[model samples]
Target: MPNIKSAIKRVKKNETLNAQNTKAKSAMRTAVKKADTAALNNDENAKELIKTAIQQVEKAASKGLIHKNAASRKKSQLMKKA
Candidate 1:
């Protein structure tokens, strides 16, 4: 535990931010998985799913939750599968 009040506040803020980032990453992964499944099944919505997945991946990168190169790689792989 932090003895200083500012340090304590910072710890709490960090916990919150960590949770938010975890959630975002989870959502991004889920979106990518969905897109992959759609592509594998040859669903009509695969393209749309890829679009949304790419957007989510980009959003995560913009928020610094994931690396920019990783995000680009994901988008590239998704497009390739689509």
Candidate 2:
């Protein structure tokens, strides 16, 4: 409901960005969960999951979707449990 034309455009752009970020975050969480479960169960796929999860986390951090410290913390925890 932006009155200004630029504001309306910005709102549209923001909505698209929000959707993309939400998808990325959701995928990251799912990857992390898979890594955690695999680690706990000693599954053979755990290594792959951990690798992919770490990559996803780093990507998110690099994109500014998540904080660097949080990314490092997640990677550390993921590594620790694996």
Candidate 3:
């Protein structure tokens, strides 16, 4: 219920950005889960999975969907698990 036109436009833009961020976050989580599972299973491709997960975390951080330190921490943990 924004009264000003600019306020309404801002709200719309925020909604779009929120959706994009949510999607990116969801993808990051899924990638992390896959990497963890692969590591747990001792799969031969676990290294690749961990690498992909690290890349996803980095991309999410770059896109401002997650904090840089958080992404780096995640990557470090994933590598340790692998």
Candidate 4:
């Protein structure tokens, strides 16, 4: 409950950004899970899955949704698994 009008608007904008960031993080996690599963199962498409997952991680980092080091670490681990 912001008393000032500008504060109220800022709060609304923060909520919207939070929701969008949550969605992006969830999608990134799902992509990583899929890539890990594909790798563990020794699927022929594991390479492609890993590539997509890495791309998603990079995009999230670039958008400031996640940390750059975290993104690089995830990509490294996924590539190692592949």
Candidate 5:
């Protein structure tokens, strides 16, 4: 609980931003996992899934949710698996 009005507003903003960040991160991880599984299963749609996963990783990195190097590593790993 924040006593000051500005502090209360800041807390609300922080909460919303945190939720958004969490959602984005979760989506990115899910996309990566889906791609990995598809690749391992030898699915025809694996290429498309890998592409989408790379895009999600790049988006997350651009948004500062993840580091650029980490995003690159994830992309590399996905491609390697595929």
Candidate 6:
């Protein structure tokens, strides 16, 4: 619905960014969930999963997808679960 050329371009850019952010956030959540479940199940690979989850959380935080404090809290929870 953007009649102006710049507005249309902005809309397109925003859509692309939103999609990327959604994907990153989803991946972060999935990684955290997997780590949590593995920890609860006493899986041998739980440590590795936790490591991966922490990395994902950090990545999200660095990208400004989540607050630094929130990332720290998530990392803490994952450690506790592990």
Measured against the true structure, the TM-scores of the candidates, in listed sequence, are 0.96, 0.97, 0.92, 0.93, 0.97, 0.98
Better of 3 and 5 by lDDT: 5
Q: Given candidate 1, what's the lDDT at residue 46? A: 95
Which regions in candidate 1 have their CA more than 4 angstroms from the true location?
Answer: none
- Clashing residue pairs found in predicted model 5: none
Residue-wise C-alpha lDDT for candidate 5, range 1-82, written one tens digit per residue: 9899999999999999999999999999999999999999999999999999999999999999999999999999998998
Question: Model 3: runs farther than 4 Å from truth?
Answer: none
In Å, residue 11's CA in model 2 sits off its true spot by: 0.5
Q: Show model 5 residue runs off by greater than 4 Å.
A: none
**Full-model lDDT, candidate 6:** 0.98
How much does candidate 3 score in TM-score?
0.92
Residue 9 alpha-carbon offset, candidate 5, angstroms: 0.3
Supply candidate 6's per-residue lDDT for 12. 98
Q: Global lDDT for candidate 4?
A: 0.96
Candidate 6 per-residue C-alpha lDDT over 1-82 given as tens digits, one digit per residue, 9 for 90 to 100: 7999999999999999999999999999999999999999999999999999999999999999999999999999999997
| TM-score of candidate 1 versus the correct structure, residues matched by position | 0.96
Error of 5 at 68 (Å): 0.6
lDDT of 4 by residue, 2-37 (tens): 899999999999999999999999999999999999
Residues 1-82 of candidate 1 have per-residue lDDT tens digits of: 9899999999999999999999999999999999999999999999999999999999999999889999999999999999
- What TM-score does prediction 5 earn? 0.97
- Candidate 2's residue-wise lDDT over 44-67, tens digit each? 999999999999999999999999
In model 4, residue pairs whose N, Cα or C atoms come closer than 3 Å (at least 3 residues apart or on different chains), thus clashing, are: none
Q: Give the C-alpha miss distance for residue 80 in model 5, angstroms.
A: 1.0
lDDT of 3 at 29: 99
Alpha-carbon lDDT, every model = 0.97, 0.98, 0.94, 0.96, 0.98, 0.98
